[model samples]
Target: MHFLLSMFPSSIHPHLHPHPHPTTFCCRNAVLEDLLEGGTPKPLKTGTTIAGVVFKSGVVLGADTRATSSEVVANKTCTKIHHITPNIYCCGAGTAADTQKTTDLLSSNLSIFSLNSGRKPRVLMAVNILQDMLYRYRGQIGAHLILGGVDCTGHHLYTVGPHGSMSKVPYLAMGSGDLAALGILEDRFKPDMELEEAQLLVRDSIHAGIMSDLGSGNNIDMCVITAQGVEYIRPYQESEYSDQRRRKYKHHPGTTGVLEEEVVPLKLEVVEETVQRMDTL
Candidate 1:
């Protein structure tokens, strides 16, 4: 009972047989345990696309407008970007609910820390608190956060893994669609990019994710955190992207339509004979 409780205290089982407590975790975990000991196979939850970059001025964050459940696209307008403090923002990946709960928790902690210290918390301080909390619950809290901000310490970006690992980087991309987006960032991101250029890069990266990764897409939500404050960009609508495609594939100069050439129909008798054969079969 103690061992089981330790595995997932608030989840799994808190009490063994001959006790009154009930199982609180998913039956999937039970099946997983059984499989580890020679039982069966099953599944897991997967979702989102989140990206962040540190430009010459500050940090820029963006994500796709999707929330997913296994193979299903749950919400087309779900946002993965969360603002935890006036100067700080988080790009969430993995479980949406977990990400929301963690960011809200971080916001509360930052508030308390600010009140006690009589000064705003720095980026690292906030990341430290988040990493520590993540380490405590670790696997139970299924959120990977890209924490970015402008602080007295200067502009910064950090990736806090779902399992509590933390690292500072110039830029990062995470979630199911990360691979495609990260490739774009790696190829084109520059250290001297201004806020506007950085936002473009973020949008293009998310666009790449939407094109190649099934779990990502809808609209692109973006924000830039600088010395002044967080600047919110209008979300990129899917209809706009579709318009771009239409413009790209539309008729070019000097090109004539098939109708202009006078499209000729095949014999109607041939079509009727094929339909008659199919009906007889």
Candidate 2:
């Protein structure tokens, strides 16, 4: 308190101050610092690159295949794109299991709804369900998703966060590599891009993320949603960053000479025995 008062002009008395002032440092940071000092900090488990775009005729969604847990790469070719319905697809980021189960739940709900209504489910319906579920969880679910689809209304693209916040955008990126991916999307995206062009753009965006972010790599996957149907492409592009082995490490069986061979045999005693069968009533 004295130190804070010293910063003010000596001409004005301390009691003469008009009102109380907020602290200069954030309370959250102070609490975090105390927690860190008390124990070893664990690395957060997160990684992935996912993006979506709305084109003239349909929607294109892209994702990288890498999954990371803290500093370790958990899966090299894991699928991030998930199917919600025939027309709606999602690209998930954050905790792998969380995203997988969340999408599975969405798919199950949408499927049931479609069956009861005798018609296809809308994209907005899926989005609403997802947001409500996420909101109820209060960000504990740890799933960030990019949803894209085509329904009777039209082509749609949305980004849904773990906290239930959502945004409708023509193009959007998510995950640790989102910044890098968004750079590519923002630079070349067009309103009326053709199917092929939109696909290529999405592919490039994911590729950019893979190249720039350690959390995103392995291969690229894409999903295209059109009025006719949905097309899911697993491994739309392979990662060029992976290095091929110069020479095969596997050697022929005879490559190494056998120094010596020893065979041990166990002596066995054989006995013949007969067992009586029991009569059933």
Candidate 3:
């Protein structure tokens, strides 16, 4: 809750010293005009993509790890989604450094709330506060954020970004893959859908993004927030669909698992080797 801790000595970076304007401007609460005068970063050629959907049980969000520089994917295992609170989570796709810093800011704000209120604020309240904070810093480089969480009241999902804009929806997508993913979501989402159905909707949206968005691919990381708490579902490539894709195109192995699953089967080769080695011992 106590923010602005002196984590390190305030020493100017060697590279930043030359570009004093950008550093000084950002360090202070400069107006948006001063920030945007610098020009927007080219809509990142590469980043992550995220989709969120609401269901009766709660809400679900999914994202993929595919970092691109212009048109080519540079890293296949970048994490686009992260847990911000025990019951709340955020998935994002945008400038990596910006996203991380923004998320950290939000996390600190939430901690402050817990300290001030003596109770966890609801998801919608947190989203509103976060959106306002981002808006206040509108001149600073922005990040696209999709937030999801579950509380005794119900489920919540929202998208926030540019100029402090925020929209709550049954579903939403962001990043280069947003267009394709939105199309998939439009066709599949239904009001009052069940948890399983919602999961499928988000999953398909993520897959469609991977196919269409050059900056998004590799594997998907999903999170489910319900009455129980926040549960993460990682990209699983051991299923029939994964096997089929493996036969057709190569997939980076590291992108295959993010969420801990209910029943992960041990590889037969590894099991056999373990048993044989145990017998010898």
Q: lDDT winner among the candidates?
A: 2
**Alpha-carbon lDDT of model 1:** 0.80
Ranked candidates (lDDT, high to low): 2, 1, 3
Can you write out model 2's per-residue Cα lDDT over 193-238, one digit (the tens) per residue?
9999999999998988888888889999999899999889988998
Ten-residue stretch with the least lDDT total in model 2? 17-26
TM-score of each model, paired residue for residue: 0.72, 0.74, 0.68
Candidate 3's TM-score reads 0.68
Q: For each candidate, C-alpha RMSD in Å?
A: 16.2, 13.5, 14.5
Question: With candidate 2 superimposed using the best TM-score fit, by how many Å does residue 175's alpha carbon deviate from the native?
Answer: 0.9
- Please give the distance, in angstroms, between residue 4's alpha carbon in candidate 1 and its true position after superposition: 13
Per-residue CA lDDT of model 3 for 211-246, tens digit only, reads 886677788888888888777877632122333343
Model 1 clash number = 0
**lDDT for residue 142 in candidate 2, whole number 0-100:** 79
User: What's the number of clashes in each of the models?
Assistant: 0, 0, 1
TM-score of 1: 0.72
